[model samples]
Target: MTDTTGAGGPQDHESDGPTGPVIRDKRRIDPETGQVRDVSAEQVQETAAEQVAGGDNAFGGGVGDALPGGEQDPSGAPQATSGTPVDGGRSADDLHPDTVVAADRLEDLRRLQAEYVNYKRRVDRDRVRDREAGTTTVVEALLPVLDDLHMAKEHGELTEGPLLAIADKLETTLGRFGVERLGAVGETFDPAVHEALMHLPEADLPEGATETTIVQVMQPGFKVGDRVVRAARVAVADPA
Candidate 1:
């Protein structure tokens, strides 16, 4: 039997035997019509080769097309020039412009804060030291007056007219500034406030106890605000 199928026709081998070769041409389908037509394999291969070459060309030119003085975009897409702004309406440098200035201002503020803290501490320390020095000076000046009172008492003249009055006034004035005297006669002997220059034996007093009187107060001591400027020099009783 003679084969009837053509090389490039549809349904040409339908009437032939089941084992006969059927040649179906490749064709682009019309999406709206669903119709078929004849096309050569060489033509399909050539069109595929052209698409591959075009893809390579597109890949190679992509960056150049996006830049200035490069190929114009064939698809009419918008392109950026060298001077164009970025997405946020700002240039590259504007994004980080304030960083240095902000850092400098922070350094300045830190320096100023440190200086202020040091100044406050210095002023407070100076004020405390000055108050302590003033207290020391006042205590030093009152020692001579106390010596005079002792001298007058030894001579049995401390109770006379203006001298007693002056002594009372001086004590009252010094008392206002936290001055206090120690080592009085007949008071109990305390080592914390008294310095024993000599001990005298007394038969009437209890053993190891201070006797009736302080025989002598060589120098009077004064305290200011709970701080002793000098220790009193006095003679204490001795148990026989």
Candidate 2:
């Protein structure tokens, strides 16, 4: 065999064979700067990660020093605040949407509560008035019977046993219900409580007689509490 391989001659190497398609770098380059300005996807991703890592320190130093209030840290970043913001730098008008909604609902509830209280008070007052009105009506209807009893007593019919006792008991029961008799002879006449059926001139007036005095009580009046149920029919004596 002929020994053609010699030292310093063309070295035996692997043959260049057909392989997979090569990737092309088609990044845009600035014509003015001859430097490779285009960055790889890996480099861009790394830069983005760095920016994100330093994001928390953005307000730490330069911008923080320029701000008015609060303390700063050694790294030029603003120090962590001890407490939360009171109103989150918002005024009453600039409150959060959820906060405003909650406040509005609370106000509505308070208004409804007030309205309910007023309604309840009105209902209670009306109930009391209705009860008084019903009682007054019944008492008024029974006035004729009372008048008959008064007439019988004046004629000495109710002077004795059962009838007098029954009248007394009825009067006591009515008194318990706040019913009261009004108007008496020799009392001061009042337009509010008494109705003058006739006027008389006083020649010799009694003690405490005034310009308007009740000389005679023709019919007694009835009242319950401060409410007058019936006016007294009376004769008034005018001082002559």
Candidate 3:
């Protein structure tokens, strides 16, 4: 039950059930007798203090998780030990001259891409407008021929013949290209669209009429879409 421990006096140790004999390294060499001595209380306390301060000596504890001073680090992450340079030792915002130049070139490339897109769109739009203008000009030039055809038809020269059929086909084909006739005798006169070639006296105006009215359409106008190619020439009757 009682045993000596190196330089320490006899101390009691309890039996750990029916197991084999336990061995303890409590002996040290005696200087005078040249024999082993029991360990002291002071040495036991020192060993315990060393184990608490340095963590588990027999089995590693908090080996890689802790810093040197046993104090909790602000961040448990390992500190950078090597002096590594980024972007050739330049700050992130103030990058190296070559890097800055490359970035500026990239920005210029982006700006050029945007400008090119805008220019292409403008060119496409102008091309469409030019095509429409060219079509409108050609159509306007043919108006005189159409007028002659109308006059001939009205005079009974193209009655139920190939000429009348050709004229009808021409008109229908032009309509498919957005060409439309403008002018009606009973409609109100608008100076923007109707050209008054003759005006009747106020006394000759129809009953209940107040504004200028188109009495006769001398020449029918032509238009394409919302654009007027030519104004309608008409005889107007003005009210008193």
Candidate 4:
């Protein structure tokens, strides 16, 4: 071997090899820009990595800046903040306040309406009960006079003297109050208003048919309005 050492590490010779040209690890020049590119690709990669790390440190890194209500970074990205954003030109809390108030008012109105209806119904029922009680009191007060009249009629003394006049006057007074007699003789007997004291069989009437004529009026009955204050006690005749 001949001495081949040159200035920069090694010198290239034509008889060095027949395979290919030898390339040296050294600085190169770009003919296009006429500037020297002294950096290797690995050095450029390391410098780019350092720049990325520095940028991440400045921006607080990752998804922290992108969160709502977060502090903003210098790169125009949103940062975390203590307060939340207002949406739709209003605060998030303010959006449902009116709806909540309206719902409460509606509930209050419904309760009031229900209470009013119940109060009306209660008042109506109480009024009806009070009227019935008053009518019952009036009818009860007239019972003694009716008993006297019935006793006089049964003794056949209803047609003479002041007793007849007194009974007529009492009946007239009761009639003004809607008091009517029930189960009179020769009238069809109704079980709703008449009580049969004795039932006798008579073959002159139709078979299985009931003779409802009041044969004897044992007690007088009275009604006020549509309600029977007293049921008539009578003897029903059955034709044989």
Candidate 5:
């Protein structure tokens, strides 16, 4: 037998037989690169491997550094020495298309729900504002008729007549709409609801009066809820 090996490993051997000398090449690891060489399929069949071996590392300097399994030995248990890439280096969700779609649906649903809530709030507010505005407009239009009725009532013209019934019915309807009159005589004078047409003599003020007081209402002011439609024209007397 003749040994014909290199510095890296035993490459081949030659032997003398009855016919002649037989030389067989049995190189395993490449002498130059120190990497394992590809064994013939016949040799692998003879060895009877249950799994295919992984390729050499094209990635980096980790031990068996293969592609998929990151956990194997040179005996080809499974290959990669580095960890498997999770979802193509993105996230685990990228691997799950259903999960990605579900997340997107959830976000859309949240946004739509928020938009609907805001729309509902705006519509409700606008509806209320429109209703109040319509009522206020109607009240303002009827103010002159109401003043005429009040004057007629003061002159005893509305004493048990069709005009009195009409006035009562109109006032009742306005009251149901939250309309109320302001600035009665002897009430405290307020600039918000009362317009002073004349300042009466302070001597006209009764005892214990502290602030300006309405002495006479020239025109009754009307309001709806907290909104003042018109201030009352009034005569005021200063406090004594």
Candidate 6:
């Protein structure tokens, strides 16, 4: 009989195996009645499994052992696609993707919220400042008018009629913006808020006066919020 062992087709012999190099003889000389080497399904399956596993069928070791590449991934992890399980079971991590931490996500959300809160506070502060500045400018321009109104009222020129009503409404409007008059007779006068044009004798000072006192307000001063629009022009009398 002619030796026709591997004549059937290609043989499954892994030249490289774990432990050492593997040599499979495909000769046609059977111990019983050797002619052509016969290939069995069981032998084929065993050989294929060994080759797929790579090293020891145990792990043959792949991230996805026997899955796909059956080789190591970029992270140095043995990678394998979905396939028959290797000799040993693979860890869950090897089968799935990475896990995301909820704490990290929450921290990021809180940080963004804090940043928005700070921005809102800053904007509110700027808005208040702008409003105060606008009020101060308007009050400064109306200082002379306010003085005329005060003088007229004291002289009984605005005791009644539309002029008195108009003055009252104007003053009321300015008051809403925190505008107020400065300087009054007998009030302690300070250089920061009072412009003194004349100084009377100490003898003319009001009773119990310890500091410079305003005896006459020639022109009333006005202010908006904490900003002085104009200083009070007045005559003063020093303490005895």
Among these predictions, the greatest TM-score belongs to 5
Query: What is the RMSD, in Å, between candidate 5 and the native fold over all Cα?
Result: 12.9
Could you give candidate 1's per-residue lDDT for residues 1-240 as a string of tens digits?
344345533443545533545455445786668876556788888777977777655546565665544534677554555445566875445556587689889999999999999999999988866775687698698688778887788788887899898988888887876778877766666677778787776424444554444656777777776578787888777544
Candidate 2 clash pair list: 60-76, 60-77, 60-78, 61-76, 61-77
> Could you estimate the TM-score for every candidate?
0.44, 0.55, 0.51, 0.46, 0.59, 0.55
- Against the unseen true structure, what C-alpha lDDT does each candidate score? 0.70, 0.74, 0.75, 0.72, 0.77, 0.77
Between candidates 3 and 4, name the one with more favorable lDDT: 3
Clashing pairs in 1: 200-238
Of the candidates numbered 1 and 6, which has the greater TM-score value? 6
lDDT of 5: 0.77
Give residue 206's lDDT in candidate 5 (0 to 100). 60
Segments in model 6 whose C-alpha atoms lie over 4 Å from true places? 1-101
Question: Which candidate, 2 or 3, would have the higher lDDT against the true structure?
Answer: 3
Where model 3 places Cα greater than 4 Å from the true spot, the runs are 1-90, 93-102, 156-159, 201-210, 225-227
The worst-scoring run of ten residues by lDDT in candidate 6 lies at 1-10
Position 150, candidate 3: lDDT:
72
Model 5 residue 79 CA deviation in Å: 24
Angstrom error of the Cα, residue 3, model 3: value is 73
Which of 4 and 6 is ahead in lDDT? 6
* Candidates 1 and 5 compared by TM-score, better number: 5
- Candidate 4 stretches with Cα past 4 Å from truth are 1-99, 150-180, 200-211, 224-227
